[model samples]
Target: MALLFWAVGVLAYLVAVFHRQSLSVAGLDAAERMGVSEAGMATLAMLQLLVYALMQVPVGVLLDRFGSKRLLLTGALTMAAGQLVFALSDNLLYGIAARMLIGLGDAMTFISVVRLVNLAFPPHRNPLLLQLTGLIGQLGAIASTVPMIASLHTYGWAPTFYGAAGVGVVMAVLLIAVLRDKPSGQAAEPGLKAAWTHPGTRLGMWTHVATQCSAAAFLLLWGYPFLVEGQGLAPQTAGVLLATLTAVGMVCGPVLGYLAGRYPLRRSWLVLGVIGSTAAAWTAVLAWPGHAPLWLLVVLVVVLAANGPGSMIGFDYARTFNPAGRIGAATGIVNGGGFLASMSVIALIAIGLEVFDDYRLAFLLQYPVWLLGVVQVLRYRAKARRLLAQLDEGLGEVRGAQEPALGTKALD
Candidate 1:
């Protein structure tokens, strides 16, 4: 029964990913449909993420208060409605509104699913399950790469979005029929304040910010355009490359998950490695005189692929630092970090592209963010270690007091 519920929740996440990527797959067509330039088209995705980032904390709080079942169903129906509006409408305002709705639903998904896993599975299994859920969820993204692009040519726009919306509607019904929250049935405390107050939660947010946003920006909005327009790859070839990114992510997730689980205290090292290597890869590609060689581009995408899994380390921090009661809010705070970074970089890229008409220059906008985030991640890691030291010292003192004084005497 637990497995069944988790699967159902994962299935909903898969659909949510599909809906999120659907617009990106239809990039040129969507631009044509909306009659917007590149900057304008970026807004569609940008606004969705803006909404998603804004809602994370609130959604996290709601998930804790209400449980996963209601949140999941509400999310699905909301996304479906967004898709419905998107499918039938040709107007730009309607399209933006639809994407906003999709972002609302998307915000509620992964954290809820993570919370569900915490509830349904044992602590030891949570890391593996979380990694698996994320890797498998990429299958939806993988589908969007080639198949979604093909669908646009075959059936046209309206039907494609309509079908995507239909999946959400179906998932909502399934959730109603099959989903169950944790069995404890214990009432949740109002823990948002405590969750926010924890320095570790803030550390988790910086870890997320440091690791995730580069990949998010590339895969979500800019990668396709940069490949096709900047690098001179054909659309079909670029789609294949993007799909490879997802495949590589699926392969790396388990390895990262294992390392994280094995070395809980040193997980930030994994994040630093990812960020450093991603920086290295991007430097090689962006600084290349022209379009980078195929091999270097491959390396760049492969390194970038690790970020998807790398970002999950943030949630691990949240789980490790907070009580289970506050995990939802902590998860939300951590989850918001990457999107916030992505949102900032996306806007910067759009502005850079407009000003310089250069993709390389535009991508360099990420460097400052990367530098700033690394400093914060290191600072917080030290803070978390100090926190752990204080906790251990307190525990030792408690133990010493409980035991009889060594020379003084035994307790009466």
Candidate 2:
């Protein structure tokens, strides 16, 4: 039963991810159809992210109040409407509005699904389930690559997006029928203050910011163009690379999950490792004298693939520290970190591209954001660890006292 519920939640999240990443493969076509410049296209992606980031706290509050079922259903319908509008749009303004709607809907999904996972699964099972959720959800991104590109080429724009929107509507109907808020009479706390007060939440947020933004920026809008135009790869080859990015992430998700479960104390180290690897990979590609070799590009893609799973570590921090009632808001706050960072990177890259006409220059902007995030992660990791130690000491004392009372009762 738990698996069945989780599967449905995962399906909704999968569809949401597909909608989120659909624009990735369609960048050039969207530019052509909307008759917009690269910066203009970036605006579409940036605005979507902005909307998504801005909505996280509010949506978290709503999720706590209404439960995952209501939020998931609404999210699906909203995304379906946005995709329909985007499909029919012929100008930049309409595209912006459509993307905004899509962003709004996208904002409601992953956190809700996460809440569902928390409700349906056992505590020990959550880390693996969460990773599996991400792994399966990334299949949506994989679909958005070659399959989406092929669809755009075969059926053109409107019809393809119309089909995409139709999928969302169907998911909405399924959610109405099958999804539930909790197993039975589960209660949720509705305060954001408690979640926000914890150092672990902040640590998770910074971890997310550090780990996720670069990959999000790449996969969201810039990567395909960077590959095709900058590195001079063929469109087909670029699509394959993008697909490989998703595939690699899918492969890494479980391994990271296992590591996270086994080495909860060392999770921060794992995040730092992923960040270092990402920075190294990007530096190698961007600093290469000319077009990087295909193998080097492959290595870069493989490294970027770790970002998504690494970011999931942030959520584990939130889950570890917060009470059940506060999980939704805490997850929202952590989720916002990456998107907020990605928004800045996306916007800056857009401006850089417009100003310098160089992908290398645009991507260089990722480093500062990364540096800032790494610093914060270190700062908050220390604070969170201190808090956790105190918590453990307090818990030990309580258990120590209770053990004496139980022993006396047994002896009597």
Candidate 3:
């Protein structure tokens, strides 16, 4: 029964991810159809992500109040509507509005699915389940890559997006029929104040910011262009490389999940490792004298694969540190951190490209964002660890006092 519920929620999330990333394969086409410049193209993505980032806290609050079933249903319908709008749009303003609608709906998805995971699964199983959720959800991204590109070429833009929107409607029907708020006895959690106040939540948010923004920025908009135009790969080859990013992420998700489960205290180290590796990979590619060798580009894609799973570690932090009542809000804040950073990176890169006329220089902008995020992660790591130690100490004392009472009761 738990698996059934989780599967349904995951399906909804999968479609949401598909909607979120569908634009990735269509960046060039979108710009052409809308008759917009590169910066204008970036605006469509930026505005969408901006709406998603801005809505996270509110969506979290709403999830706590209304439950995952309702949120999932509504989000599915909203995304479907947004996609339909996008399919029909022929101008920049209409496209921007459509993308924003998609963003608004996309904002409501993963967090709600996450809450469903918590409600349906036991605590000990959550880390693995979370990773699995991400792993599977990325199939949507994979679909959006080579396959979506093919679809666009074969079926044309409006039909391809119309089909994408149709998937959302189907998922909505499934949610309405099969999804539930929780098992019979479970109650909803409430309150964002506690979630916001916790150091661990902040740590998680920074972890997300550090780990996720680069990959998110890459996959969502810039990567295809970088591969095709900057690296001088054929469009087909670029699509394959973009698909490789998602496939590699799928492979890494479970391994990272196992590591996270086995070494909860060391999760941040994994995040740091991903951040450092990503920086090194980008430096290698961007600093290469000319178009980087395909192997070097492949190496960069492989490293970027870790970012999505590493971002999941942030949610693990939220789940472990906060009470059930605050999980939604805490997760929201953490989730928002990545998108907000991604949005900024996208905007900066767009501006950089417009100003510099060079992908290499524009890509350099990711460094400052990384530096800022790494500092926050380190700062919050210490604070969160201290708080966790104090919490453990207090818990040990409480358990110590209760053990003897339980022992006496057992004798009685």
Residue pairs with colliding backbones in model 1 are none
lDDT of each: 0.81, 0.85, 0.85
lDDT of 1 by residue, 147-169 (tens): 98887789999998888888899
lDDT of 3 at 168: 92
Candidate 2 lDDT, 254-347, residue by residue in tens = 8887786665557778999999999999999999999999999999999999999999988877776666677788898899877999999999
Best by lDDT: 2
Q: Which stretches of candidate 3 lie over 4 Å from their true place?
A: 182-190, 388-412
Per-residue lDDT of 1-412 in model 3, one digit per residue for the tens? 8899899988888898999999888999999999998899899999999999999999887777778888889999999999999999999988998899899989999998888877777665666677788899999999889989999999999999999899999999999999877423323334577788887789889999989999998999999999999999999999999899999999989888777655544677888899999999999999999899999999999999999999988887777666677778889899998899999999999999999999999999999999998898888877765765555522111111211111111100
Give me the displacement of residue 218 in model 2, in angstroms: 0.8
Model 1: worst 10 consecutive residues (lDDT sum) = 403-412
Q: Against the hidden reference, what TM-scores do the models get?
A: 0.92, 0.92, 0.93
lDDT of 3: 0.85
